[model samples]
Target: MSDFLVVGGGVIGMMTTLQLADAGHSVTLLERGRCGREASWAGGGIVSPLYPWRHSAPVSRLATWSEGFYPELALRLFEETGVDPEYRQKGLLYLRVDDEAQAERWAREVGKPLERVSADFLYAKEPQAAPGFDDALWMPTLGSIRNPRLGQALRCRLEAMPRVTLREGSEVTGFRQSAARVTGVETADGIVEGDHTIVCGGAWAAELLERVWMALPVRPVKGQMILFEAPPGLVNRVVLMDGRYVIPRADGRVLAGSTLEETGFDKTTDAEAKASLRASAIGIVPALAECEVEHHWAGLRPGSPDGVPFIGAVPGLEGLHVNAGHYRNGLVLAPASTHLLVDALLGREPILDPVPYRLEGRVTSRR
Candidate 1:
């Protein structure tokens, strides 16, 4: 069995470790801080892309393939770790959608369930939604997961695996290389040797690649979110409108997010963002105005071109791979991304074409 070093412990890294370990490979997951406390923990966990048609075909393919795994994966995690990811297919409603015709055509092409609902039907499904909205595009098959819980569950499962080693608070400072081939990585503690090293360091992936004299397109795009402890049914399904979303949990917690700021690596929450998000949340569901804000936080998404992640071998470098740059859709796309990474590493036929994710053409010129 191969020894693999997975750098980063977000959903992507953890999922990769799980897949590799399941395949009888030994995995060491190294995290700079607590696993899942970054974007993966902070995300709203909409299992599907906010607007599936708006994303590229590669992004859609990964998300669609990953969608099939959540129900079973969630149950398995719960059964194995007793932490319910709270994966649910409650559906997503795109209120005030920009183009119904385009959405319908894309839905038809994808063969995913899509329905145009009048305001009456929309209100019936989400009674708390604000009034005066003419209609919405509903994708009933879409769903969400509580990502923080998901992270907890994954951590628990990984810790239970005999072949998996989780190094929390262990930062990968650089690579251990043999000529053009990466042998492993250099941690603060010392050298950690492995047969293969995969950089899944989320927003910091670009920095890691830079250490190897390589360039990557991944950058840290800051996003902020606000939460409310409203009633369980306050926001029934995942609601998206004008690029904002409100995701409801099983319990009495509701999350409304987010702002896509190009601020580099700045995760500090702003009062302005909180106020704006609060306004947006109350605008969508007026009853939310009655609920006090429970939490306001920010996370750095590993932003890439068109929100498509890089998920293959770093060209010109052997024994090195990467699976980051899944901005916004990381949680939804985790299963497929990890599976494809493992498939490529093990020389197995991939479930999806990996061409779109290669870093050769996508990486920016050296900074």
Candidate 2:
């Protein structure tokens, strides 16, 4: 069996490594920081992104497949790891922000369950919801999970895998290349040798590949969010409006976020961002304004120009692969990405066509 060296320890890397190890391959995972504490932990944990219909066909394909696969994965992980990721179907209440017609048409075309609600129904469902201009769209099957708990579950399962070695706090400084193929990884301590190397480094993927002259257009797009300690039922559903959302955790915490900025790799949370998010949250669900600010933080999403992830074997580079540039849907897309990558590595007929997500090319994500 071939051994693999996987970079980065976020959800994408960890999940992929876990799948690889289970497939009877020896795997070594390197993490620069504590595993799962980065964007994976900081995320809002929505199983489906706010506006899924706007993404490209490849993206939508992966996302739709993932939506069907997550429940089973979550259940299996919980049984084995004793950590519940709190996957729940709280549904989504998309307050009409942009063109309601566009949202409705997209929903029907994509076959996503979107029900139009009268203002009275909206008021009844979320009484504290800020008085909105009439129209509302509700999706009954959208899901969510506590991202940190999901990360923890994966970490625990990975630690118990027989042939998997996880090196936490070990920073991968560079890769060892031998004429177009990556042979191993160079970490802060020493060189860790492997036959195949996969880079899933979120925002840092492009820079790391640049060291080997392999160009991947992955950059850090910072997103800031605020957490509020509200009553358990303060926000019944994921209330989304104007690119911001308020997600309610099972344990009385509501997360309101996030602002997308091309601010390089800076993951700083300023007062303005906090205020903006909180204001958005209150505007959507007025009751949250009284909730105490629990914490505020930021994360760097691996953003591509078109929001499409590079998810196949790198062209001209034998034995090298990547699964990054997920932007806002890393958690939602992790399971499907793993299946897609494991198939590519094991040389099995992939469950779906892999051409659209090939390593090369920039595909537009939104129309």
Give a tens-digit lDDT track for model 1, residues 84-196: 99998988988787777888998899899999989899999998898898888889988789999999999999999999988998999999989889998998899999999
TM-score of 1: 0.97
Overall local distance difference test of candidate 1: 0.91
Off by over 4 Å in 2: 362-367
The superposed Cα distance between candidate 2 and the true structure at residue 144, in angstroms, equals: 0.8
Local distance difference test scores for all models: 0.91, 0.85
RMSD of 2: 3.2
**Most accurate candidate by TM-score:** 1
lDDT string, candidate 2, 1-367, tens digits: 2399889999999999988888889999999988899999988998886788777877887888888877887899999999998888868888865666776787888898888888898878777778855868888899998899999999999999989999999998887778878888887799998988888899998888787677788888899999999998777778898888999889879999899989997887899989999899888888887888999999998888777788888777787888999989898888888789889889998978888778766422221
Worst 10-residue lDDT window for candidate 2 reads: 358-367
